[model samples]
Target: MYVGQGGLIMTEVVGMVFIIIGIPFFLSGTIGLLRLPDIYTRLHALTKADNVGLGFVILGLAIQATSWLEVAKLFLIWFLVLVASATSCHLVADAALRRNIKPWTKE
Candidate 1:
């Protein structure tokens, strides 16, 4: 049935799907952080989770937003998150390298 002028029911369904997909990425990242054997590997998990999880969350929010202003705000927030997370991760990795943290070597 039609829920609203802008198809609220469909939008809500898509938003739910996006949120559900994002949850798995977040969970996988957490697991990686706990289980990975090295700092580099852990960084991989963090980056993947940060990008995918934020992307999905933002997409879901955008789908549900009824106004262009709200959607633009959501996009701006996502962009900021992406930049911040990537830059922070890079700095952390560089610091670890400078401190001589040993990387995993294939034996």
Candidate 2:
């Protein structure tokens, strides 16, 4: 609705650029997940890359947000997802270790 202002247009363009930049990170993460040889490495690729991608996307959305409250909420969601992904990755790796799953290595 706030589409008439020049500032709003600039912000929207910047936000779109951020989102476009983030897409490759997501693609690389997907590629790594498929190409990597083992669970640990796959998890590393997905969690780290995807987290950064999502962060950029969220940052872009926040930039275009109409209000401070919405911006804050977007950042909060990003932080929560960041923490959750790290925790879940750690748990999965730990479980794999406990079960004695070997990490794939180049010989």
Point to the candidate with the largest TM-score. 2
On residues 28-83, what C-alpha lDDT tens digit does candidate 1 reach at each position?
89999999999988999998786888899889989988899999999999888888
| Residue 75 Cα positional deviation in candidate 1, in Å, after optimal superposition | 1.1
Model 1, residue 66: distance off in Å is: 1.2
- For model 2, the stretches where C-alpha displacement exceeds 4 angstroms are 1-4
The superposed Cα distance between candidate 2 and the true structure at residue 72, in angstroms, equals 0.9
Clashing pairs in 2: none
Tens digit of per-residue lDDT, candidate 2, span 9-82? 99999999998889999999999999999999999998999999999999889888889999999999999999
So what's the TM-score on candidate 2?
0.94
Q: Candidate 1 at 60: error in angstroms?
A: 0.9
Could you report the Cα RMSD, in angstroms, for every candidate shown?
2.0, 1.6
**Cα deviation of 71 in candidate 2 (Å)?**
0.6
Output the worst ten-in-a-row residue range by lDDT, candidate 1.
1-10
Clash count, candidate 2:
0
